[model samples]
Target: MGASCLTDTGHEMGSISLTDTAHEMGASSLTDTGHEMGTSTLTDTGHEMGSSSLTDTGHEMGSFSLTDTGHEMGSSSLTDTGHEVGSISLTDPGHEMGSISLTDTGHEMGSISLTDTGHEMGSITLTDTGHEMGSISLTDTGQEMGSISLTDTGHTMGASSLTDTGHEMGSISLTDTGQEMGSISLTDTGHTMGASSLTDTGHEMGSISLTDTGHEMGSISLTDTGHEMGSSSLTDTGHEMASGSLTDTGHEMGSSSLTDTGHEMSSISLTNTGH
Candidate 1:
């Protein structure tokens, strides 16, 4: 059995269970075993094998489940197999992707086994299980790549990770089990460098480690058997060099060590007893 319902201004439906049910243009709620919905609110149990689509120009939803597609221009809340355009909380294997305006943009995302990518020049909290790459403008004309925490074998690159007008950066942590090369902290005019920690077993060559102008460095530690050459851990002028320690037997050259200028030095320990 099936039911066809239509409402131009407003409509409300409850406790609907059918194989093929169509609804359009209004507010509605369905607790169906399998059905279809359009431009309305739904509390579906097994709709289209737990797959439903919704286009919300302005509406609100609470505790949704299964596969549901919603284009929200206002606000909503979703869980598992759902896509939202406005603001929502989603969790599932399905990818949650959207493009928000600069004036109206704010997201708090936590992805366990999915990739969430968004291009909003506002405040965002992105946690990706895969690769997440985008550019954001925090303030006026100053782009900032907010706190990034990656745990997979992917690369995250931002054109400009800045905070102030002078382009300052916060911190970056890449904890991968494989080889990760060329990880830079800060690279801007008059920009300082934050702490960099690389704990990989593979070779890390030509790694600047930490190079800043007119700023101080935190620390540098190389605990791998791979050779680290051409590492520039030298400062230009009015800068102090922190303690250098190599725990690996591999050779470390000035071209591969971290270098700074016009700033205070923290400490560098290369405890590699072989060298």
Candidate 2:
């Protein structure tokens, strides 16, 4: 059977196992002579042997018989691994070994990784790796990387990457990297990315990528990312961001960047991203 316990005298009288949620490590027997060596804290040298001939170097030991030498020893690869070691994370400051290393190493590692790669890294790297890394809906990388392309990354990256990366790096990275890494709602603005739902009057009611919607009553609603208030169904609403009823007279738009929808229209309750 597997050794399960350890004694105080520094002996492996039972099995030894370690599992990490951030890194996804599995438990293995540290058997070495069958005496069932007890548990022992990792030392400065980070060298340890077990009865099953298991060897762990530093904190990188993950599999049954693997050796790692870096901050994220068991995270993934060896040497300067990301999050767990080589994994991606919003707050991670190391190299990402995994395929989707979000905000791992580059300045805006998170945004770049999520968008495409090396795109938002430039801007994101400087300020918001955790938040902006995946900011601009992962397209920031292309904008930051190309320096001119502004194609996919530019359109989305420049706007979202710059803002989101600078704010939600830590929180966004954890949640996205964990599972929903591709969600459009980059910032905590509560608006779906690509889709113009952030606005009222059914913005992007048809297409996606912050385009649809035509009303001044729904300021900050991702309304005029392309179409300005001159589009349609809007009165003399201020240029700033605001939220209110889609009727003839709505609240005056403010300098703020959040809109709350009202009634007298097709689905009220609007919230925009800020002019």
Candidate 3:
């Protein structure tokens, strides 16, 4: 059954429902369940669920939900047993499995995994992980494994393996078997980790590594085995690794590492590991 001059689902489900100014001003739509859904704007679109979708100008207060999972502005996926999850304007997917994993804006990065006996698992990815670059990961021992991946521009984890991870920012990989990991700016890794990594502003900055857990910064062109950076230069590897001119700002980790891992960020020769 249809309704007024407005058109479409007008008064079809319920009174004042799906009435798009058929005769009034701001008309609202009702769901199949008989619940009042969203209101229509001037030229914008109304809200819809299931077979009905919301689209148009700004999407204002559009919302969506499926399989008991819901989303306010972005998207949310709840497996087995989970709760409310949200991402930013870019791309950030939050997940859980009998557990909950969340992140803010500046705190965009990494993953959260959990495992016990039999539980649902999932992973989340952020379009923008770092200040303007990178990626992240997280994992647990539960059947449910949640991961958070981010965008990259400054720092990145070529391939990260995180376990029992936490919040990650900038670019860093909390990989390996760790008890509990925290945040970072660039690329990083460890066995028992907890800290942030930093990247460079110019080209490939530098990279860092940690056994007990720490942060790594710079640009790159290689693997983040132990967390490291190589700003605006070629390539290099190692724990606390740093190559290029002002590679490591001034912290030599390996036998032939860079000198300055900070500013004065210049170039470097294969022989001159230092500035």
Give lDDT for model 2.
0.23
lDDT by residue (tens digit), candidate 2, 1-275? 12322223222333344322222223223222222233222111111211111232212212122222212212221111112122221221222212121222212222231232221222222222232233323322222121111112212122232223221111121111111122223222222111122222221111112221223222222332322222212222222224322221122232123233332233333334433
Which window of ten consecutive residues has the lowest lDDT sum in model 1?
A: 100-109
> Model 1 over residues 141-197: C-alpha lDDT tens digits?
223322323232323322112122212334333332223334322222223333333
Candidates' TM-scores? 0.25, 0.20, 0.24
What is the alpha-carbon lDDT for the whole of candidate 1? Answer: 0.28
Task: Report the alpha-carbon TM-score of model 3 versus the true structure.
Answer: 0.24
Candidate 3 Cα errors over 4 Å, as ranges: 1-99, 102-127, 130-135, 142-161, 164-202, 205-247, 250-274
- What are the runs in model 2 whose C-alpha is more than 4 Å off? 1-186, 189-226, 229-268, 271-275
All models, RMSD in angstroms: 15.5, 17.8, 16.3
lDDT of 2 at 222: 35
RMSD of 1: 15.5
Best candidate, lDDT-wise?
A: 1
